[model samples]
Target: MPPVPQQHGHGMESPSIFQKSEMGAMMGGGVGLTIGFIFGSWSIIRHGAGPRGFMATLSQYMLSSAATFSFFLAIGSVIRSDSPLALRMEAMQLQLSASNPILRSKAESAQIVRARWAEERSRASN
Candidate 1:
């Protein structure tokens, strides 16, 4: 009878630190803009006790709305690729794992190589 191979321990490789920072910044900016919009609009709506104040408030509201829309539009344009950040992260992790010495054993290395080849073939096919 053949002896069973010992199982190796390998944690998944992590995402690129840069991509994570970018994603965090993107999300943070989005949330900050949302909060700003809400508070700015509230302040405009609640304190317009005279015609001049109301006109000024209305003008500010329109400008704010336009600016917010443009900012998000720019972000949408920048991230227009269908490949999401999570997918990019997964590919990076796979690449790092495939290259790392600690994760590369004879058996595991062979398996990783075959898997990578298969992935490439499929990608080429598509």
Candidate 2:
């Protein structure tokens, strides 16, 4: 009988909570800045804010929206990092072991290799 391979650590480690939160904040801020810029520019253009007023209002909207976005994004990141979704998925994968398409494909390939090995052994014996 062939020795079974030992299983190692889980496939890939998820990012740390801090890293996730930071990434979320950056992405949210970028999105918010884009949205704020578009709306702010449109408003300033439509309402004919003078140069100074336009600048002030635009800056205020941009900063406030970005800050709000970052806060929500950080909160979402924290929730995701601490969620049980990943654990549930892993458990489901384990439970469905042989039924998993990826695992099934690998198993089929291994069977082909084993059959070839057996054929080689038989030929050598004969």
Candidate 3:
């Protein structure tokens, strides 16, 4: 097969959809676990749990965190598979403009709005 032409201007290549989804899941899980651990530790310390009780409480918190992480992972995977990011943002903008008269009144042409939105989104993501 011929080599795929690389696009210039974008500073770095974007991750594949699957990679993005996996990263999202990993990040979500890490955050969930961190939060759960902090809360669990606080609760155990505040309640003055015995060693056995501490272990039980810790286990419960870990399980709950795992569930929350898994939920986010599933959502991330579904979102990545279902639509491209640009399309999703366009839909969101449309909904926002429709619901807000002030925003609608100030809206630019679709082409200009989309170009600016894409540029800003890329900058922010980077």
Candidate 4:
């Protein structure tokens, strides 16, 4: 096979929930900061307040607004992403989870529970 050009790198783009959500949060925070600044400024202009204490309060409000927007946008983006839940998990989760001792133990416990449930069902039937 002929070596593909450097620009035409492998086209397999794995969609990851964490990456998508982080991107969404950053975008949302930027928007929220702009909005909060405008609103906060307008509010101060209307109310007519002190420069020192009032400005401090206004800055706090802007930061809070940015945080709130970031949080909700992150969750909303995750929910609205095109990928199915299973695929989303596959992309974001560490590949080592399968070999991780904690995960393996949890999986084993689930199997034991399934076996017990199957036995119960069989006994009830008989």
Candidate 5:
């Protein structure tokens, strides 16, 4: 094949690693907040609040919020732990593990997988 003309002379596009990780962490934090709100509001309402109950509710809310924040914080740390290089390595690992033959074979045994793969393959060949 003829070599494609280069825009930046073969240099690849470089996205900021920190920004990408922040986005994932923010998404995880949103997920955690959603979980907390869905579960925590009901918990407070169900329990009701007197003076001690008020304190208890505040405590629970703080605990739940903290839990949510920490969960996302951990996700960010994992994603950006070693900069752009580590992130690429982790992505490669995920792709390899997810496509392993043993796992794929097990999935193929299930009727759902058979139907899905057949559909996908047929679609692709078109």
Candidate 6:
């Protein structure tokens, strides 16, 4: 029996909470910015900017909306909750365990290469 590549024991790890939070914040900020721009433009057309000036008022709206959304979203996964890295590792395991000799060999070799590269990178970083 061949040895199975265990995803859990392997050096591969799911995205950290911080990474997830950052992703959510980025997504929310972008969406909020777009929405803010649209609403600000409409507001300017309908009511006109006060003495604060059009650019100033528009920017205030954009920044406020972006900050509000990013803060809330960063607290939790507002858009993406799953780690893509986990998904990739799962897919790789399927290939590595495939009954087809060629596919298994390729997957095994790829896994070995990646592990070696990661080791080297860690060494270099230190």
- Number of the top TM-score candidate: 4
Q: Could you tell me the C-alpha RMSD of candidate 1 in Å?
A: 14.8
Give the 10-residue window scoring lowest on summed lDDT in candidate 3: 98-107
lDDT of each: 0.60, 0.79, 0.72, 0.77, 0.64, 0.80
Ranking of all predicted structures according to lDDT, beginning with the best and ending with the worst: 6, 2, 4, 3, 5, 1
Sort by TM-score, best first: what order? Answer: 4, 2, 6, 3, 5, 1
Cα lDDT, model 5, residue 39: 61
Q: After superposition, how far is residue 23 of candidate 2 from its true place, in Å?
A: 0.7
Residue-wise C-alpha lDDT for candidate 5, range 1-126, written one tens digit per residue = 466743433576444566556656666666666666656677767876656765566566656775677566757666654455777887677767856523345555697777988998999999
Q: Per-residue lDDT for 3-116 in model 2, tens only?
A: 675333575545667877998999889988888888888888888766678779898778888888988998898887743467889867886788654445778889989999
Model 1: per-residue Cα lDDT over 6-115, one tens digit each: 33246434434445445555665566557655765677767653566655665565556556655665466446433346687976787678565254569988999999
The Cα error of candidate 3 at residue 56, in Å, is: 3.2
lDDT of 6 by residue, 52-102 (tens): 999999998888888888888888683455567667887887767757423
User: Which regions of candidate 1 fall more than 4 Å away from where they truly are?
Assistant: 1-12, 49-126
- lDDT for position 89 in model 5: 87
Candidate 5 Cα errors over 4 Å, as ranges: 1-14, 50-63, 66-70, 73-126
| Per-candidate TM-score against the hidden true structure | 0.30, 0.53, 0.45, 0.54, 0.39, 0.52
Candidate 5, after superposition: displacement of residue 64 in Å? 3.2
- lDDT score for residue 48 of model 1: 51
Report how far off residue 15 is in candidate 1 (Å).
Answer: 1.7
9-91 in candidate 3: lDDT tens per residue?
47645556666577677777777788788888888888866667888887678668866986788577757553346777877
What is the RMSD, in Å, between candidate 3 and the native fold over all Cα?
11.3
TM-score quality measure for candidate 4: 0.54
